[model samples]
Target: MSIIGKCIGATVMAIAGASMAAGDPTGATASPQALALLGGLATAVSGNLAHEAYNKLGDKFGPLIFARYPEIDRNHHIIIALRLSHLDAVEAILRRFNESRSSDHDRERQEEAERVSELIKTYLREAKRFQGDTKGGRALEEREVLAALPKAFETALADRSGATPDVQAARHETEAQVLAELNRQIGSDLPPLFIRVFSGSESGQDGWYDLFVRAAASRLKDDEAFKSIWSAEQLSRIVHMLSLTAGKIDRVLDGQVIAAQDAERRHDEQIALQRRILETLSTEKGVPASELSPILERLLGHVDVPIADVPTVLANAVDGLLAKSKTLVAIHNDYPEIDRAINEARNKLKTLDIEGALTTIRSAQERQKELQKEQLRAEARLHFEEADILRPLYDHQGVIDALRRGIELDPEKYWQWCALGDEYVAIGERREALNTFNTALQVAQKFSGEREISVCYDRIGDMRQAGGDTAGALEAHQAGLEIARTLAERDPSNVDWQRDLSISHNKIGDIRKAGGDTAGALEAYQASLDIRKTLAER
Candidate 1:
């Protein structure tokens, strides 16, 4: 089996091995390719070769491979073998890729661990800074730790990533360690305010606002010396300022958390695309690396394209290949008779007959071009069929892009322009929507009939109303009503045009009412009611 094939088989086997160890049966039957790859791996040399194969697979597939097959013993064996083989370059690359793919939550766990360690160091430093002045230093030490306590608690409890059992345990361990040191250093010395704020069982209770409120209330009520130093008004001002500051801090933290989550989501999407590309390349049995490289490069480049556009972009690429294939088919049809002459020339070249060989070689070259063209045409047709199959799977943005392309291809199609305008409106790009509607209206004036012109004006009026331009909306509606009135007068039997005129009158009435012109509004509503009564009777 090929190296690529072996990688796929090994991946399946590795996953199956993990499942078996966990007392679960492999849920589905393995594919023939997977079985073959597995068989190849089993029959191959053990230690170095097996490890090298696994390393190459991991290098290509990244951390997702190890995550799926997380058997520690197997991982250890591979690492030992890799080291013995002295494949430092491969080892380093795989290590970097794996670390990059490891759960970001684990990294965040480590960060919390480091933060608590640093807090301990800082506390020790602060303790030593006032080593000899124990009487005065006690209050300063309590204040310093109180100020740092919120951050330490935040590190322990803030939602950094997925809080699995392991993550929770790690966080709890760090929180306990930090709290223990804090209690040991200043637990006895802390006032009732400090104990009330930080002694809660939950980490989130250590927030500065809660701490400030409790501390202030305690000092104001119990400490008569504290009361003599400050007025009630002064205390109220301090609490108010603290509340405002805490509120601002909470908003900034919320924004940062949201931005971080969005970044992580994008990163996961990119990793998924990479895994798909790797899996696809591994499964293609006989495709040469040279031929595959360009396809792989293009797929990698497209990883950054918005997910909605990927399907359409891929389909269009296939269409381009199909067009090239059609050109080849035409060439093949024009050169049907050159093959036999080329074969004869090749036979003469064996006898050192240079002139005959040259003539036959030229004929053969022409025939080869024709054959190549035929092959390309066949491949192109297959690609075209595949693209068609994938068309329905494209998303809303893909559909919009395709529609826009269609409009560009047939610029004179006023209806397509109108359709694109509507799509733009659906997506909330009001500026683009208005521009598209105006463009459609311009085209309608030259190539379309009065109904199309009336529809354009109606759509423009709606957009203006949505934008809060009541006067502009009224003007556009009036223009549409004028066209509708003309069309209705020209063809009295056209109910659609008459209905449109009534709609315009109602819209004008709404605008007049909103602008506080009750008399004008009443007249417009009366006109609309008259049209509706006439239509209802008909």
Candidate 2:
């Protein structure tokens, strides 16, 4: 095994052994010292490991600790420090503990010393990523160092109760020195950004903001201005609430940035579409190039009109343009390019060839039918665009109406069928939704990609699952999974297909777990995790 692998194995065994040795059978009574040492060991092991490795270690060990110690889970300062990779704070914790026990010379003490030394060596070996050691003054330095300091200090003083007066005095002096430094770094007053709590799930985070607030309050509590109005506990609560509010504000700002980006993207697409429309009008509809600019400017103003009026607006505009183009044709010509067919039929009539004339008429009817179909398809496209606009507004009825209109005009559009089915689901019409989805499945199987067919199956599975039909849901998901597997195997380099395969596995796992098929669920979940792990590695 590699050096890091060996370190991981040793660390896990050591922690597990300690927990097992605890008198409490549940490992619930493991001493704070043991848990702190465990955290210190984690900090050391994760110092040299990749972020993925760090998370994996946490996932493996966090539950064992949290299940027995819910309070630690609630106030997970050490976990936050690990996440930040704040070497200074974590190292301080270990150094303080080791310093307090330095005079002990027992065999167990020596062994503990050896382990701590090895762990510190492991941590310092890759010290370049640590704060102040990074080469290029990397822009992102961890602030959780400051946030983790209070917990570090608290852990350091955990053994103060049994210490001699001199030792206790020394610890108190160290605390004052650290608090003074903290007060200097963090200002006396909290910022206005943290005045309100986050909109959803206040205090629901894994105690990250709570830890931050505690660190800030630990320093601020000594401030003369803050001390005048608020007690220590009240100050802590206020700071915690403010931090949550700051998080909410940050999320709102992020959403605004995303919305701006999306709007710009849509604007670009609209410009391209408008350019194509203008080009078609100039070349195909015989509109003069000089007149196109003014006509386009007028048409652009109509975009402000409501979504329901879009199809009618589009049809009227196009029909008026077509009428204008038709008037430009010669008076004698009822249809462009039909003159030859008319001439042929007249010649046959003159020759008394009634059968040939009838054949020409039938051909003309077929041509008219093709033109009518083309017109219907054009109208359908307008309705589809209307549906797209309505979707974001959550006007489900409008979307259903528009999609249904489009489907009526062009039944071959399989995606429209699927979309219509989704709208049916939104309206709580399960029977109609199922029938529509089945129709979509049939259409998708006939003409769409296998991916779409799989999507249909997944949707059907969701519906069945919601209706207490676990077996049916599993069957449908398994069908989708088979298709996804095939697609992924066919093109191993395609990230999308690989992701689809993983999603299929996860869905299957969920269904099996719901149905009490624990073994099958585990197998499916493992397969999904394997794919996701490979993807993450890449």
Candidate 3:
């Protein structure tokens, strides 16, 4: 296995082994002469000793041996050099391959050789960086190998090696194959790397983004075209979408950690409470503390004891003590309710009526929860009313505070989030307003609230427009317009829906006009005018 294959885990190594084992009859493993017949690299395997030479090369290179050598021979010395980390040998072979290429050599074959040679060179260069020397005197550490190989693979994917269309096509095909091999070499690291790269602080796109973009470009088989499409806005959208997924996963993991900590804390508290009660009972009864310690352990010290068994365990222990002493029975009189409840639970379990036994407690818990929810709902209503009162008074801060409180209590109410966002806009808090509106949009989307969703998009568009992001603004407005158009078509007689459609068209027109897209602006404006005219005539 390669150094990168080691870091990435045994799974990738197994896959690579499987692929080679499945048989590649056209590959160097078959004959080396067939490679010459396929692409005109007859010089690569010169003497009758070529077959013997290939057999001596070992499994280190696998299919790459076929891909790598064009004019270079199938001598096993290259394998020995690579094993000894002899980068100079690799470099010499590449230089020789390029030098040997001419008008006589097959152009397609030469380009494929060039592409594969570059991939090997690039990967070696990257892997050598951690070695602190240009000459490869030592092997790469697993961590360094893991870091370098993926980067090299991504770089090769993005690189345009030649000027001609044919060369570019050949390079693209070679890159796909090389990248697939790289994937086999480091597939285990990709998912964790993706999560790590995509999660955390929102900042400008970095090398990790490029790495993903490479994968996407390779799949599309158009590196240059794919790169051209990645405008600032497009990149931002991509980052946001990927980061959102990573963030969700991070949150779920965080929640699990917190829940585990909370459970452990509760268990510790329960053990402490049991110990305190036992200590008090022992002190009051003038019983030796050592005698009560075993009872406490039976009740709580055993960490594996199921919580459900606690009631029965305690009841049995108490019955045992009470049967042995009148003093304990007199003492148990003070805690008759606890004893009775435990006895009741134990009896229910014995009779297999567990649900019925817990009904009284569950009902009380449910009632308390209902009362709490009612209180919170009433409080949220007051805050929303306060926001409404403050809105007309031009107290944007007050409105924001009230709406925020209301949203905290009733997060599902998308309108409250929208209202809060409006207050942020009024206060000229563009980033805050944009984020709040996005939150509103997410809530609306969850419920499939089309009108609310449209409103959120329009608000987000407005913020983007004010921030001088014409492209982003246009996209957001177009999205809102799509939803508004659907609503208007579904009910043309609805005046509000028709008005919303007109406003959405106007928003798109405004963005296009600001962006110097005159024809697009005019078309959008005409649509808005037509909608208004129909509404006015009605």
Candidate 4:
């Protein structure tokens, strides 16, 4: 029934209400707290009150709370909460709190004496003896009769100092109880003020690379440690890794937002995320905000700026995260459960089968890497040096659909387009396959002379072969072989290029033999054999 608690509980009730309206939850409303926790998980944020006091606290605790209540994420109700933060509405909250008081102290509700002002104004028309203002946690702990007295109170019919015994005694007891609660709150409920902010540009490590290596290089000049360790290549790798993680988070978020396949389960993942963050924040040992690095402050505070003059509003966020991130990282390193969850979820995506070990992103990268290797072996098994492999987890059409989505998100990811071309082949849509391959070709051409582009030509040949155009297929194969040969010539010492040329030659020989050109086939085969044998020696 507390206002700040309403921020957490109300949000949960709202979700439960929504779930009830949508359909019956097997266990919803069975335990309101359980359901409420689900709502928190769906939101995956820290306590609103904590966030109002410290930005990092929200980031750290939101996840922690959800983790404590795994059921919340599975049945979470807020799809947009992830994009919003407690700080987003802190101003309104402050204003609302200030407005609620009648001619009293500051809006923050500090001090038991000030709470008396509101009590006299609201609970009694005129408490002639009332003075000062007070409210909140510290106010409620009072055991005195005066603690019960509201801002408003009835005026004494006569001066209490001159009243009869009965009247004097009544006022005395009332004042005693009223003062008790107020005095209690003064010592209890009040928390230090701070602010919490959220940012998704990328994780902290990625932010470090971008700000230092790309956006503003000047900042790096002062840090000899960073400068000594910096390199364009290393920075690029960092950026790339950050980008991949960001994408993974985004993709999982997208899938969860859509509530795809047991949508409730997505809530569970978020709950886990929140719980982990909290456990991290609560346990970490943090330095003073002013003493920390500027970037570190920005990341921990979830904002960007100098820390010397922390705004009352921003201070809450800055303080919380400073203490939170360390706790989150420390506890999480010992438990790779999140990793297991994500991998399982991605496996579900890969197979379109969300069964055991699916519906979670337990080891997606590992699975993807494994798939990439599988695809590599499949292509290597083929005679074409640059064979493109497209293995869609869903149906051929579904593969196309997923590819379309992937392309829309990142046109630079040509490999997915090449993957989509597989569906065209499966459905006997050679023309579509050819056109898709051509699109892949265009994307690859952007990175000209790359082995990927050479593979595109192999795709073209596959399209020709599928279309029963042996002559065109043969021509495509020969052209690909020529490109591979030229690339090998340009890098005589490069074994990969040499291998590529060999593969192409083997394919050309296969095509010639299929065409009854035995003599030509023997020559090409022998030459390929000789080249491969020589490369093996070197």
Candidate 5:
């Protein structure tokens, strides 16, 4: 025997020997009677008979051999079967192997199963086409069919996923038409091999259809008889068509499986939604149970609510509960007061004096306003008095806080705003002082006279000059000067207004001189001198 053959034989013998030794009834060796029977059988078997006997022995222990060593390929099994001359046994074993590998849960196995199914269909169609045409017409017919198969498979697999029922039905109908055409071409000449392999009438349990197609295609490639009749190109075309058909089948089957899974998922979601609704209703105590009865009835209606629509329904119900809760809380908290008001209004309506009732309501509203004003004034007085006490202790911030409260209570009080701005300036908070003074000026213009407004402008200009903003100081001083001039023009005999104008002109001159405007500064000073002269004469 060849070196490889001898090695395989040795391996098999070693496995069998190990099995026998492990199962030995006696601790030492085989029984005397069993040894005598083995000696006789060995003596009778020789050469080819000995090899055949070994093959039989291996087959009897096939499962044990595989269990002991799983890496053994189909080639090894074929060698054993050929040696024993049990080809049918090899076929049965392979059939079982293929069936064992088939699974709906395994994607790769499902894809492979689909591939073999399409290959069988392709082989049947090609065989029919070849038989229908004469020898001279064979090549042309083969080319036409080969060219069409790829495009047909491509179109079928393109939108296989999420296909509507009508689309799926149309595809199946197309496949049926193609099969019927093939049947017509072959007529009564349909080969028994083709019929047996392609027929779908058999029960699908054994998974023999896929096994037979794989075996037939493999055999045809190696068969000398087939090679003589079909060109290399024609055989290649058959192989190509089988490949395309397999891919198409896998795509279609995958889409169908995914679609079924989606349907099941939606059903599960609906069940979960129903359970959630029950749980929510059981725990809910805020909203009246009677108000939610319609929602519950719709949920349990004969026509089921889709899972997608359940969230919106639940949200609306929650919003209704929230609104109702607010109403309930209001009624619970203010029930006594609301009840009294309503009773009073009802008594007035019963007296049939509508105008008197309206007048009474207005009078009550006016009194309420007066009381609110008195409360505000009391609060303001308390804060202002506290500030006066805190001010003697040098609590300038406390003074500002008190003044802010007084101003907030009565913003029309210009004198209080002037006091607040003066407080801000005393603390060296120039920015705050400037803003307060501007606000006070606005209020004074509207409520007080030019005296208060001019004082605010004069303070603002002093703050700007101290903060080194000469241009800003000039602007503020010029504004104060204009206001002082207006006041003095209105009452020339008023010494305070005349002095205010003179002070404003002097400040403007100082700012201009500080800004390096010699001529402008001189003119401003001359104007200040003229104002001071006028004030002195008065």
Candidate 6:
């Protein structure tokens, strides 16, 4: 824009800023609002003036003024820097000129240039182009043009300037067109991936989209198409990553719910188990055992529970029918055997085996049979208590079995796969354990549960090794290790990954040994051991 045009535009912006800053009754905070409005108006006016100058005086005239002034040449530099939307540059120029304290004319000129530079810089900064075919964007280096005004004004703004009209219009039109096209490209792209590829239960990611847009625009320095396509591609990657992340998050959330449910189930079972044992220990009329005691005892971890607190269902337990809360604080300490007897009596309660229990109790007095008799009494009592309490859980066998069955029915469900794998671990069933891990992996590949995926692969390697497919097992283990490595790199700060990586390395080492690659195996073991040591210290 011409020096005259900028002055006119600045005047209009100043008027608007003054009015708003005067405190209109609308209650909007005035300073920022005025600043914002002033910046916008100034940019618009400058744009119009530049367009006009491009049309009237040709591209080179009144567009610059004080830039050419010999004494004011430095201010022109400040002007251009400001035009480039660099406030720091403008401030820097002001500091240099203002501190010099030269003649009044120089100071006045410097101040005017600084004010103009500041307003333009502020607008350019606020007008950051984050999206469009322009990608990293192309802003008018308007400050550059204005900065030239001090020097160039002598010739360009002269009454009979030497520049031509056609040349000027062409330059302005082309530059404006490029900037507009870039923005257009960005707003038009990116919708297809947003809709089709993202389907997690909780999937609304506008902020992510915004970041992609900024990155895309940043890449568009040379060509519009490149930036536009770059943005679209980035958008796709972000969506895919988000989908994977969301799926993993859901798995954890689901697991938490299942954990709570399982704990509740166990606690209820324990209570039922204990109640039956209690009922069985009571004698035929109302008498308790003369010197009652059961050798076999089940102990849950200690808890800080209030003695007066009502029995509440616990969240986790063993032996489906044990009453952890009741047994802990509520039980009588003086008659400690009462607790043991009650537990022992439950095993035989369902069988109505009063005769057997009495005989077992008598045998406890004999030195040779003392421990044996107590063990028998305890087992018998447990069986009776378990029988009745087991009914409800057994009744839901269809669902439990269904889940169990599904674990095999589809190897892809990590929850199911992990379940069957755990069962195999308990029974020393290596073959089944290997099979279960395979099932786990099938489901895991479709999502981002790398922890379980690594587990499944490790098990597969183990199975393959047992079956004498040593090379194949080694390959599988290596693949698992590679997967862990990739996950760790992607999330560099995840501490748990250290352990996961270590375990994977150990598996790799073992696989290498089985394949007759002793050296490789040693390296793998060393790596795993090192990671393990680090984790231990942490």
Query: Runs in model 3 with CA error above 4 Å?
Result: 1-371
Stretches > 4 Å off in candidate 5: 1-350, 389-393
Number of backbone clashes in candidate 6: 41
Instruction: Tell me the deviation in Å of residue 23 in model 6.
Output: 81
Q: In angstroms, give how far residue 282 of model 3 lies from its true place.
A: 29
lDDT of 4 by residue, 271-314 (tens): 56444444443344343322323323343455454433333323
| Candidate 2 displacement at residue 425 in angstroms | 2.3
Tens digit of lDDT per residue, candidate 6, span 384-442? 34433533564333433444544333334475555556556555677777777776788
Best by TM-score: 3
Clashing pairs in 5: none
Pairs with steric clashes in candidate 3:
none
Instruction: Write one digit per residue (lDDT tens) for candidate 1, span 228-327.
Output: 3333553343334233333333444456579879999998997677555545543543333333344444744755766556544544543443343333
Candidate 2 to truth, TM: 0.37
TM-score against native, each model: 0.28, 0.37, 0.41, 0.27, 0.34, 0.25
Q: How many residue pairs clash in each candidate?
A: 0, 1, 0, 98, 0, 41
lDDT (C-alpha) at residue 106 in model 6: 37
Q: Rate the local accuracy (lDDT) of all candidates.
A: 0.50, 0.55, 0.52, 0.45, 0.51, 0.44
The whole-model C-alpha lDDT of candidate 6 against the native structure comes to 0.44
Ranking by TM-score: 3, 2, 5, 1, 4, 6
Root-mean-square deviation per candidate = 30.5, 30.5, 23.8, 31.9, 34.5, 29.8
In candidate 1, which residue pairs clash?
A: none
Query: 344, model 5: CA deviation in Å?
Result: 11
TM-score of 3: 0.41
Error of 5 at 487 (Å): 0.9
